[model samples]
Target: MSKSKTTIAKPSVLSDFKEITKMRLALSVVFSSLAGYLLGVETVDFKTLTLLAFGGYFMVGASNAFNQIIEKDLDALMDRTKNRPIPAGHMSVNTAFIIATLFTILGIGILYTINKQTAMFGAISIFIYTCMYTPLKTKTPIAVFVGAIPGAIPFMLGWVAATNDFGIEPGTLFALQFFWQFPHFWAIGWFLYDDYKKGGFFMLPTGKQDKGTAVQCIMYTIWTILVSIVPVFGFTGRLQLSVVAMVLVLLAGLWMLYYAIGLFKKMTEKAAKQLMLVSVSYITLVQIIYVVDKFIR
Candidate 1:
């Protein structure tokens, strides 16, 4: 008697690629760069915007791939990241390296076509993220501080992409996002404390989930809001905000701060999770408002 063999289905290449690139997160980062491009350019250049989007994605995508490869074993131990392609054995390390290398070249090359500084920042973001940040995650909580440098570069990268200059305006954009990262990241750290602990990453400022950490979240939220409103007061030449948009952006910031305050008061996982959600919404809304306000006024 002959028996038929059953064939196991493999995961689609698209899903594998998406997981490797972390497409959603990569795309969101690209949106920040896009917002900066829109704000910096007097006239919208669709072609450049399109290139920036692809370049930003590839840069960020490559960064994530390198991070996963570096942390594959650690990722497999954490509940939140255990299913990632590299950690789950769905993809090989060499394959990921190939994809990341190709992405790095394509992304930087595309950004270079716009301007060299833009490409330089993109390359720097990848370097800081993959080299400094990845290795430091297990060493100290300062890894978060190191990570934010690359994390915040996208906002300023857009301005440079448009103007090919690094001055007060791009610096202002950089400051806004840099301070914003503390609260946003700490909120995630608070809620995922145990999971992060399992993965040997201390993300909170105080090295524990405590009042000290919550207080810093509140403090940084305040700093982020203040920096966000600087353009409203006409503090920068490249970026300006109308009174209406200023009000709206402040409202969004307050919404995030409100949750940060909640985390400080209760210090509960639920509070931390809500704070994280609001923080994401606040950044996204603020970026949208900046672009819309620029065109409207």
Candidate 2:
């Protein structure tokens, strides 16, 4: 009986850690940073890449843990978040705070070893996410706009990590991810409108599921697609994409755009969910294509 209890209890503890840190989300953020690093690097340094992966994950994980602590009460009010570690009674706020604090220290320290710019951006991402975005989520829809700042950083952070400089290359990467956030998040807002309302979060621009929201999604999708293709025009300096990669990138964006249009026409929860998934795939595919193009060209 004692052995069984220990075995079962271990998995629960691991699950709580996963919930508190939002493991999947943290990994995806790390992927973006790694992708950015790959794009800017002429010769890969596995040491720096490994540091980036761990440091980026720790940074994002810390932000998420702090966010959960701040929103513990609000999270319990919503179906989606009610099962999180803190709200579900699997972890204490104090414990989460301690974890978050340690992750923040480790994250910043690891990043600082790379360069000042990389560490600075990592610290900035955490501050904006926990201090600004978390608090604003309940008060205004503009929180999404503010939240996009940190969301867009990882991709660009990688470039700075690789080049140790902030230039058109990193700037273009920043612009690409920055514009992509609106449509991606709005689709989530559209689908989870009711759940968000329960937590007093006004996620959509108009705070409702309507054609107006869909129109903005369509508009931002266009902007994201346009920004993505800018590297092919040769103006973005070291971020240039070959014509072949540019065409492939265009097709991927159009695929996402098709789903966005479907959401507009259907105006249904299912359509919104489809758009969200497609947007995720679109970004990941675009990143892969960009890196592949850089190597072949």
Please report the candidate that would top lDDT against the real structure: 2
User: Tens digits of per-residue lDDT for model 2 on 173-251?
Assistant: 9988998898899999988999998999989988889889899998998998899999999999899999999999999
In the range 1-297, model 1's lDDT, one tens digit per residue, is: 001111223445567789899999999899999999988887788999999999999999999999999999999899999877777667899999999999999999999999999999999999999999999989898999999999999999999988889988999999999999999999998899999999998788899999999999999999999999999887798689999999999999989889999999998999999998888889999999999999889
TM-score of each: 0.96, 0.97
CA RMSD of each candidate after superposition: 3.7, 2.5
Candidate 1 residue pairs that clash: none
Judged by whole-model lDDT over C-alpha atoms, candidate 1 comes out at: 0.91
Model 2 vs truth, CA RMSD? 2.5
The list of candidate 1 runs beyond 4 A from truth reads 1-11
What does candidate 2 score on TM?
Answer: 0.97
